[model samples]
Target: MSSFRLTLERRQQVSTLRSTTTYILGLLLGLGFGLLVLLSAGAPAATLLDDLVIQVFFSAMGLAQTLTLAVPLILVGLAATSAMRLRFWNVGIEGQLWLGAIGATLVALSDFGSESLRLPTMLLASAIAGAAWIAVPLILKLRAGVNELVVTLLLSNVAYLLLQHLLFGAWKDPVNSFPVSPRFDENEQLASLGFGNLHSGIYVALGITLLMTILVQKSRTGFYVDVIGRNRTTALATGIPVTATITLMILLSGALAGLAGGLIVIGVEHRLTQTIGINTTFSGIVIAFIARFNPLAVLPTAIVLAGIYNAGGTLKVFYGIPDAIVVLIQGMVLLTLLMVQFFSSYRVSLLRQSAQQPGQPST
Candidate 1:
């Protein structure tokens, strides 16, 4: 008689078939769960399906809005992907986005910036502010070895509070009587690409994605980062400037997130609102993960996520579904994909052995 045991072993490399299968399964499972929720809610599954698959994605106006929403997602998704590639977990990208908006607001509202310099200065200010926002966490991690995930997450709340304080007090729109800031001038706005609801900022985001792809996939600094991600000790022993490299990567990540905020202000919203940029950071993280940290792949992934998220309103209207369902769907997809990622890196099997003999541990 033989006894059997099941064990998991780490894989040296994950095959494309395995990776692809994992993503497909995640997609199907997530949609299945969403369908169950709709049925339980007594909602029409047909309307939900049409809203999700046709209205938001196939309609002309809907497609425009989807791409417009994807602009910020693309920027922030690329930002997260960059840091994630280096194994730097930056959960404060949302805060960086808010801080970036603050910086742009400071410059945009200032009389010192001439009309010619106004927009450019605002964008630059936002990026610099974003980088500055992440600098604190990076320094602490490098010096005191504190956990960045906790610090970054907490800092995000601080950033949101600061944005609220300013909007509710100094930056409050005098005319609107709302908690929103004054809208940017005509000269400061991004033009549409002849498509209603879509802004030219999508082009800028696409260009930046291309540049980042090159920097991360081809540059020597990027190579160092990849190695560091694989093994920090090995990278350090190999004479890589681990601290400096990580610092640069973190700053750049923050800058990208900041730029995204800036674009949202000048392109879509044309002003800062209480809800203008909420939850974007988390959605961007999901986008990055779904894309597998590939900067180039982030384009389609961002668009897909954007279409789904932007359709939340339609789902609510057509099926009486709540916005929470959208969040739940995002979470489920992310969880399933993460599980697939884990499985891709490991193999599971059963080993049988004689009951009379001592069995060795399975690798």
Candidate 2:
């Protein structure tokens, strides 16, 4: 008897050089596919190229807006990366972000804090709210064997509804018909960086990104997280505190998302409006994946995504290109990256069984 078999085995260790190459190739392929789509949509190739290189990226304060948008995207990327690194799916990043804004808004509206204490207190409140939002799901995950992914996603809607309730009801600005909170005091807002719409939040985002990169690449806790992610059984056998590590990571992830929310409120919007919530959660997920969940890579990835977001609006106005085109490109990038990851991580082999010599089962 004979049998044919196909198998896939992971590489014992993949080199950083090879990993980088794979990512670059994936990015090129994604852009190429996006170009084809644009061509099919009646876009002129020369103008497309010009807009992509100049107007969308560098012209007319484009870079500043891109960097500003990147602030929250970077934090959201870090939050998603932390949970994903542990093989845990924290899809509630959007919810955590909204909770952060809520926390910040509550503090901003309160009269208990002194003017000097306002900003710090608001940020702290945001972080705590984000962490607390995740804590409920974490309990479900650990004790009830529930899946965090579904819980987090559903909770995101809840966060949105909660935000709407406050905005349309209590937080509604009396002077205007809009469902928005009062403008934040100058002392409570983040200091500007003397750039177009850019603020100190960018520095905060960069600092956090660097710190996360160091923690993941050069620390013992990072090693433990890696082991647990690779093999839970092995991690447990090696005396790693899998439960505690998971808990810590979950809380940290939520806190980072909350920080993003606070940053958006304090730095950009300056008020809680009906539209002022985590609209970039999907974009952050894209950034994290494009960076291969590497904390160090997340910064550049976030910048790239932020460019697309900022530029897409420009394209809509100047080139008449719909916003959906940008979305199509993002989709292509995500799909191509997944394909690249699969090919780079595993190899398939075919085998044929030898003829059986006895009555025993064929081997």
Candidate 3:
């Protein structure tokens, strides 16, 4: 009698063709899985494709909304990519964004700069605030060798609490009696691009994405980051300024995350609210993973995710399905893509063995 066992062997080198094929396959599988999830959630199967694909991507209104929503998603995706490049998981992205919002809010309320320079000043303050917020976890990680992941994740709660304190207390709007800040002046808000809900902030997000791509793919710091991500010991052996390089990248990450928050306030929300960074960090992380942490890929990945989010709304309106179903679909897609990555890096095979009595001779 023979028994067969399955084994997975790591691939020493994966070809470009195989990689591309696996990526496409993963996307298809993920979409199929999402469809199944929708079907189970009581979505009308006949119109699912039309609502999810045509209505979301083909129509002018849907395209505009998706692109508008993609703005912050792109920023967060870039932020996550920057940190992941150095193996620094900045899980406190939500906190950094909130701090960025706070910074921008301060500028708006104080009328800190000339009308012409006010928006620019607010942007600068936002980036600085974001970098400052993440510095706490980065410092502990560098100096005490603490896990940046844990520290960053915990710090997010602190940031949220601070945001709540401001909203419910000092920052509350007096006239409306709302837990929100005063509306931003017209000069402080992002200019509309005359395209549905789209704003000039889309241009800003695109510019930052292009700059980040260059910084990561063309600059010397990027090379150092790649080396460090592969092996810190090797990076140090090669005389790379490990500490300084990480500090730069992680700060950059925080800045981008913070910038996203600022964009939401000035570009979309026009005021600070407690709802500012809700669940956005996780979506950004998903976008980064979907893009395989490539800066340029973040744009397209963000658009796809924005569509999924829009589709979720469609489901709610058309089929009365809850928002939680969309979350479940997103989770399923991420899980599927992860499995594809694993299979792409390894090959599975079966081995057979024959069993015989203790004294019997094997043929």
Which number leads on lDDT? 3
lDDT of each: 0.84, 0.86, 0.91
76-98 in candidate 1: lDDT tens per residue?
99889978888778899899998
lDDT of 2 at 50: 65
- Candidate 1, residue 191: CA error in Å? 1.7
Go through the candidates in order and give the C-alpha RMSD of each one to the true structure.
Answer: 3.0, 2.9, 1.9
Q: Candidate 2 vs candidate 3: which has greater TM-score? A: 3
The TM-score, computed over Cα atoms with residue i paired to residue i, of candidate 2 is 0.91
* TM-score of every candidate relative to the true structure: 0.93, 0.91, 0.95
> How should the candidates be ordered by lDDT, best one leading?
3, 2, 1
Model 2 CA deviation exceeding 4 Å by range:
1-17, 349-363
Question: RMSD to the native, candidate 1?
Answer: 3.0
* lDDT score at residue 70, model 3, on the 0-100 scale: 92
Question: Candidate 3 lDDT, tens digit per residue, 127-227?
Answer: 99999999999999989989988998998999999999999998899887779999999999999888788889999999999998898899998899899
| Worst lDDT 10-window in candidate 3 | 325-334
When sorted by TM-score, best at the front, the candidate numbers are 3, 1, 2
Q: Would you give me the overall lDDT of model 1?
A: 0.84
